[model samples]
Target chain A: MVKATPLAIDIHNLSLWYGDFQALFEVDLQVKQGLITALIGPSGCGKSTLLRAVNRINERLGDYVRTTGEIHVLDQDILRNDIELAQLRRHVGMVFQRPNPLPLSVRDNVLFAHRIHRADEKFNRRKEDEIVEHALRRVLLWDEVKDHLGREATGLSLEEQQKLCIARLLPIKPTVILMDEPTSALDPKGTAALEELIWELHGDYTILIVTHNMAQAKRASEETAFMLLGRMVEHGLTEQVFLAPREKETADYIEGRYG
Target chain B: MLTERVQLSTSIDLDHRGRDWYTDKAVTFLVFVGGISAIVLIIGIFVFITKEGLGFIAGSLDVREFFGSLAWRPTSPTKPTYGILGLIAGTASVTGLAMVVSVPFSLGAAIFIGEFATGRLRETLKVLVELLAAIPSVVWGFIGLSLLNPLIIDIFDVPVGLGVLNSGIILGLMAAPIMTTIAEDALKAVPDTYREAAEAMGATKWQVIFRVVLPAGRNGLVAAVLLGVGRGFGETMAVLMATGNSIKIPTSPFDSVTALTATIAAELGDAPVGSDHYRALFTLGILLFVVTFIINLTADLVVRRAGRK
Candidate 1:
């Protein structure tokens, strides 16, 4: 079922180790541009670990975590020693499982990433308002929060905060947005709202989401990749993988057997 | 198994107080005593100082003359005029200078320790800062008397080395370790997620610290600074030795002057019991107490505000 679409993310035999214990083993995942791809697995299956590797953010754990092989984003090798991490991160924004808006007003949180990356540019109030309004509108949170734009972002509801987290990344116009269980902390209603927002955002930005919920992977993503025991078991269309799995492990996991 | 269950049920008392209850009660009482002692001692000290100084305040002491005039001659033969305007100025000048010297130094050290250093180096620097805090004020005074005294004199070619400049620098150094400790704790209290989120947005390390962590910890940092100011205000022995104890208002950083704390420290001995001079010294004690109380209260309120947020 190969298509003519160019890949947004191309990973080649990626292996990672935290100190002595390896977390990922020669996993390769190619994510198509302008599509939502979900990585679903049981606990310790290294789904989240694989997502964190795309932007190399897991290295913040210091020199302990070592990575081998290459990760190229939009045809640029991100694993190069001389590459600027700030520039890389600006192009590849992240949304954490728990929504972490900085201790800033809603307006400022939306403008924070933009301001830092474009530090030399001078801006007036109208331009900043446009940027904040544009991003919040994309997340479908503009009308609800427009009146309280000066309110602290943390004071918002969990769903609104999560949407704001995604909005803050939008102003950067990231090539790929990586989300690690973006709905793990939300209630069922909030999760549904966020899934809808993600669906609404497709074709504008490439999305790679990691989730523990198999149903969410089926419901929200066009393509799904299942990992088991730190290895990618299968990658295919969501329907074919869930409805008719080829790998025995994927079939066993989807049917509620031992993980 | 059924018989054992019955026996275990028979020994269990649902409502009875056990060893855990008694231990909890003991700890509660101990904590209450520890907490209340500070309040009680503070009130007791305030009452004692007030009683000692109230007699002079109520009698011939003119409030305007006492606060307005620069004349601090409590021992003038026929007409003793007890004015502390000069002493207040001296203390204010010295403490102000100390804050100027210590605030940036302590804050920079705190940032370095909190955001930059790691592993053994961070641990070692923290231990050293705390050790610096433990050094006796008398030793700091001695350093001012010997080391800074000569250095200041050589630098400015002033006749008197023991003055506001010497003492201010000395007290600033003395207050720095405690300030650094408190400020570092404030920075540490900022959540790590804020830093992670900022870094994920392509912020440099300094940018993350400057924009996010520092602003999040603003209340704690303000409290640390106020605490440092209070420490400088109440410091007696070091200021007494290093400030030259010359009863006059200082016009510049190089002038010799005395602090309110230094005055009380120096004159309380020579003044006879219950004499006006003795009461006047106690009066200075009351002023110092009140000022320090306000400063400490402000600091506590700021920290509590941080807690609420």
Candidate 2:
């Protein structure tokens, strides 16, 4: 079954409502394995909502948010009621617009998920050090933070904080990562550094990102999906979607005629 | 460039010329007075209590006898004894018991109200718990007298129902509402971003609360518990009505005793005006004041530090 389908995430006819208001209407998307995909749209276009729904994080917003239809991650039906959130989330990680690192020491922040989900599992100092070093190095933060592993994660700069947030998710070995405009809070230098890092991890993990910057989508993603007013307007190869004239809405948005 | 030039040329002066200036100054003066009133009142109370309490301690009563000896016979004709050791022990034991009873339950209630409950249910639980705070201390005392007193006697098989145990239970219940409110506020004050981040990393509901929310709000939680301690320490009428008001150090929770606040409340009405007995009661007031002042000061420091973070 896994041989035939190379998709990491598949969504079908998904509709979401926030109380009386509908945020997403029959949105369908397919993210291939081992590639970076960007979802871009205006502020209220439900790009972030779509990203949140992939990992079911939107359920925490409140009970008023109602969702229907199916989301499958790595061929597992995640929308089913019996699906365990902890297990589902272990396979699908997320990064937010703001770098919300736990108010903990750098090492603890990296090991938080492993510590909680594997509560009964015992780890020696050597194993813990290996885990922290491996995860931090994956995000290229080990060099900057290795000397001060015991210091507070909140004390790091905004760029390092975002990288640490990404590193903290690595120990769980998630196959799919959903980023909700992860570099929005960083400066241009931080954004470029993070984009480079994301590019480096291009083929090892499937990444779906929500962004408002058209330039970021053009620069970073292999595939891009455009949404407007809770509908997926276009989905294609990043270059083709940007250059070729397809839908009028997509062209107008890409040409900067209107948001 | 055109817009910038227009904006620069058409800037409005915020410094109003006539009555508006006076209005701003008047409002500022009122706010200043309002802010300083609490400090002035506290200092006034300190001055009055210390002045009245200092006379007997300086002249007649030995410092050792006042603080060291446990015998508390203050009005005896032969030899008047005024050691407050017994009273201090009573207050300490009852406050300790109150903390033991209230902290766990109040924290549990706070977690439930802050994390688990939905909109209507959350609002309902909050209103109910806050209503617990609005219930008068005198009413709580009466409840202890009529309800808890009989229950205690039946359970422990004690001679009189009033004791450290009964008063401690009453004070704990009375303070739980306040503790829960403060703790819930602390828990809710943790930004939603932390919860989302933790949840996205596959943390279970309880794990997110215990590991992230609770630690982030630790200062507030400490402040809540300390404020509850202060409230328990300063509680007067409930302990007065429930504890047997005996002037002895209690060996067990079941034994009758008089808390410092109870001692002052119970004796202040009968003591003659401008007498040594009256002054000693004021001394007990000073002791209570100092302990609660220290507690409140620590709580303020914790809150301020948390704010800075």
TM per candidate, chain B: 0.91, 0.90
Quantify all predictions' global Cα lDDT against the true fold: 0.93, 0.91
Candidate 2 segments whose C-alpha is farther than 4 A from its true place: A1-5, B1-39
Report the Cα RMSD per candidate: 2.7, 4.4
lDDT of 1: 0.93
CA lDDT of B274 in candidate 1?
96
- List model 1 lDDT by residue over B191-232, tens digit each: 999999999989999899989999999999999999999999
**Model 2 per-residue lDDT tens digits across residues A168-258:** 8888888999999999999999999999999988898899999999999999999999999999999999999999947999999999988
Docking class of 2: medium
Highest TM-score: give the candidate number.
Answer: 1
Candidate 2, residue B120: CA error in Å? 2.2
